[model samples]
Target: MAYPFKEILQRFWGYTSFRDLQEDIIESVYLKKDTLGLMPTGGGKSITFQVPALAMDGICIVVTPLIALMKDQVHNLLKKGIKAAAIYSGMRREEIAITLDNCIYGNYKFLYLSPERLETELFLSKLAHLNVSFITVDEAHCISQWGYDFRPSYLNVGNIRKLKPNCPVLALTATATLLVVDDIQEKLGFSKKNVFRKSFKRENLAYKVEYSENKFNRLVELLVQHSGSGIVYVRNRKMTKELAEFLTRNEIPASFYHAGLDSFVKDKRQKAWTENKSRIMVSTNAFGMGIDKPDVRIVVHFDIPDSPEAYFQEAGRAGRDGEPATALLLYSKTDVSNLKKSFTNAFPEKRFIRTVYHHLMNYLQVAIEDGIGRTFDFELGKFCKAFALNVVQANNALNILERSGLIQNTDTRENNSRLYFLAGKEELFGFQNQRQEYEELIKTILRSYSGLFSSYVYISEQTIAGRTGLSNEQVYQYLVNLDKAGLVKYIPQKKTPTITLLKDRVPENIITISKSIYEEQQERMKRRVDAMLYYISSDIICRSQILLAYFGEKKSKPCKICDICTSNGQQKDLSGSIRKAVLDKLNRTGSTNINELIRDLTYDKEKSMEVIRFMADNGDILLEDKQIKINS
Candidate 1:
């Protein structure tokens, strides 16, 4: 029998009821059915699987592509007193082996892992021993080629399903079109067509578009007017820093975030913002996944997003607590033109793509038919410098190579430093006493960590430094000295992207680009870009309606709080009615003096002149020689 889900939710999460379709999704998964859930951002997606996992008899395996997300979920679960563990890239073999063994014997309820780990021998060997309740795939849209941010690694999810055929599958995503929806179902080996989707209409959030020549000034004005925590999204890393600095100069408590920052710095900045130490986070798209701060009053897009899906997901980050919030997009005509140019740069010419392919092989020192299944620490700037290639075009070519299955690039977070004793306790004691300088550091390491004698352990240099009253650099140097003396073996942390060769290198002439597939993807991208551009350029259409209709909601009502709706509503007030009446009289009489119109219409003379002035400014009428005439 299943556990009481409502009781668990209240006991663990302190919620009285599930939001939207969350209860239904949990029930479907509890009944051992394959399900797909399309919940918008902050739709409580984690609970759909998390609550079910708690009520089940065995563990649930969660597969995702983002290491940060996996770590965050695991951390949150642990804080809730739920037993969870995760295995990701950059972990040692011994550590992974021990983690997998714990799942079998330690009664761990959840095991989070990346899709690449599914193809490993260690994981496959341990797959049959433990019972799995269900399989949850987060960010399921990546399985579809039609979706933005596609990852080929996500395709391995189907293989995991085959290993645990009895277990159900629950797939979740924040944004997906009809095409992507169908593709996810087929790719993930869904048992049947079981899907639960929440409506994408955010009634309480106002979507606003501002056209401005000086965007920085307008941004500052908006921030001052709307007082609350917020996020300002820029396009590149440099912009993240520059904008954050600009906000600070204006007296706003702000900081910048990007993927290139160190892991410790990222954690510190994110914590400060989450706790309200900082009022705003100016960042790239790398920020704001799995963030639980609910009172973000605004989300500003300083740069135009590449697609509507990305825009909707990022904009939906606001108003998670269900209070009133706003999603503001600030852009100019020049920005739109630049976006068009970027689209061309995003997919370079076929010849250029092939050139990048050859150059990458040479850069990595891989000969033809060699370097299969090898991972390299790749630096994009270094590669571009070595070949004299344009950075934008070069990165786009790398993306094309990834889509073509030539290589895979993963942005890995830095792992913590690791070390273990190479000598026995007696030998280490003798050495430490003989050296006299290393005794305190050795004792501190022993107190902070255990079981280091037989296996390598993840250790924090900062923690050790604090305990021993030494600097982190001193601690690191002492560890290196110990390693050189054969008292310990140390592995410093790694903090760079890993590029893996999927297939053996082939000659540039034999490289194949599927014409139909390429053309179809290009066409789909064009439509998405066009839709985003339309959202920015349109002034008369409801912003909410466009977003809703794009996500397959064909009959959504206009959100009356959007910029367009608000403007149109304001134009229909009493003044607007009076203006229409005055226009009618003028059209009939051809022209009229102010005093004559006021006397004939018998309306308020001051209000009448105000309406006339508004009309004249908006090009509805012309006032020449004190006569009001409608403009032709």
Candidate 2:
């Protein structure tokens, strides 16, 4: 039987049709079948579960790792008159209780939450009470150790399934290898044959890898050539700012986005870019998830990503509107060497990992067998400075600990600003009269927000600024003043990561990092780096084909628009010119060295070398180290 899902999709998302496997996945879920969806980024992954949940009988519980994305989806659903809520880390116990209770009693159609919440006793207690229709796991690849971004918390999803034994499950991921796909299904408890995978091919997106020494100049040229909104992905937060500033100085309307920025600033920058106030976003990998902007004509990787899965997802952010688009990866020999070194550095010694753990316990003043299940505001830089530890090594050590399930780290930028009024309305009356300076601000707060006296409320300074006609800074100052005056208890927004101890502090000698697991993870990472390097240096295969093959798809035809295919034509023409020049010069000089030919050529030395190497490899010439001779 056909459901009214098309009508529902139109009502909520205003889309007339579902993309690729969306309708099939939705149908399977609505029919109560365990399903796994493998759609590329921007392939309407949310609609598969959301539309079905809307058509189903009870609330759908969405498990995702991204807390901000969870809240964003809930907010969007609420705006469309669909009751939805999310519970994540940093939320008060009371808030979580209320949200879970609402899911049980308030007829909420959706309850989005992080996978970490599944293991909590409170969530487990409420899980038995929720009238769960189905469970949707986004970023399903994270459950597998083989996946590019593994999260140990996702392992608890199986526990959730035990609570609601009969509820069907839908696992969603944008990029997953064959290994990850099988792992997700097994981990999620798929009942039977239930996998829906769309091809990883994006026909309209031309994947290009260009060798360029001057990346910034090439970036400007590409941005000018492709006249539309785009994303420039860089490796580090500092580079995001620097590259964005450089682009702006070169007259490109650009803004930088990273997890380090205040939530309000991040939102403002994102909004400006999304609305076309800025034509480009220079960002870290954190910027792309759940962003629905279409018509992005280009996506340039300023630095190579850690894996092909990550690269595919990041590049897939372009051309969502289905128009022609370019995904350009700037390549250099230096990038490859540096990336390998960085990966090596990212995995510190096992002894170093244990030492960092010891120092972390000491830094937080936690004694052995104490501080279990406690969350602390952890600043890596501060901890490193205090303990005389290298920041990079410390970070890697923390990651190893996290992978070992010793601790959990939450970036506090993901935490929302919270406020609570300490004084009741009547009690504030005297203070309001005494301090006329804060009277209007206090009045505006009371008028605009609800339940400020009862609990700490998640507040948006931007919303307050709009309501009170004050700048965000001014609004923050007012909250700080209220806190200082003892009229309110305000927690200003956090920009550092929060570390939560999953288990009690143990003896440093007792801590263990699994040798097999560590080796396996390193091998996987090495394979990914090799794949990315192969994509960069390969001139024979289609760029799109290489990506497709990496994801376990075979026999993909060449995308004619990619650099490899297009350059194939130019390469032939350029090969003829270079061959003649080299032959002409060789004949005149009677087999000179390679360096002399390079000096004699008017073309770029790099291009000249590449041409000479290509000719030698193809048997038109013979290269013996520094010497070049025409093959007899």
The clash numbers for all candidates, in the given order, read 0, 0
Find the 10 residues in a row with the least total lDDT in model 1. 568-577
Candidates in order, TM-scores: namely: 0.83, 0.85
Which ten residues in a row are the worst by lDDT in model 2? 568-577
Taking all chains together, the TM-score of candidate 1 against the true structure is 0.83
- In candidate 2, position 271 carries an lDDT of 92
Clash list (residue pairs), candidate 2: none
Model 1 ranges with Cα > 4 A deviation: 14-16, 92-94, 414-468, 478-491, 568-632
RMSD of each: 9.3, 8.4
Error of 1 at 67 (Å): 1.2
Q: Per-residue CA lDDT of candidate 2, range 1-632, in tens?
A: 75898999998899898888889999999889999999999988889989999998999999998877986787678668788877877777877786788689888899888877888889988888888999999999999999988888899998888879999999999999888899899988888868898899998999988888888888898898889999999988999989999999989989999988877788888899899999999999889888989989999998888789999999999998989999999867788788898789878888898899999999999999998778898888999999898888788889878988899988978877877787888889998898776777778877765556644556788877887788889889978988898888887777668999989999999887886357778888899998888678766556887788788875566678888778848654554566679999987877879998989987767767866765564456788879988787
lDDT of every predicted structure (CA atoms) = 0.85, 0.85
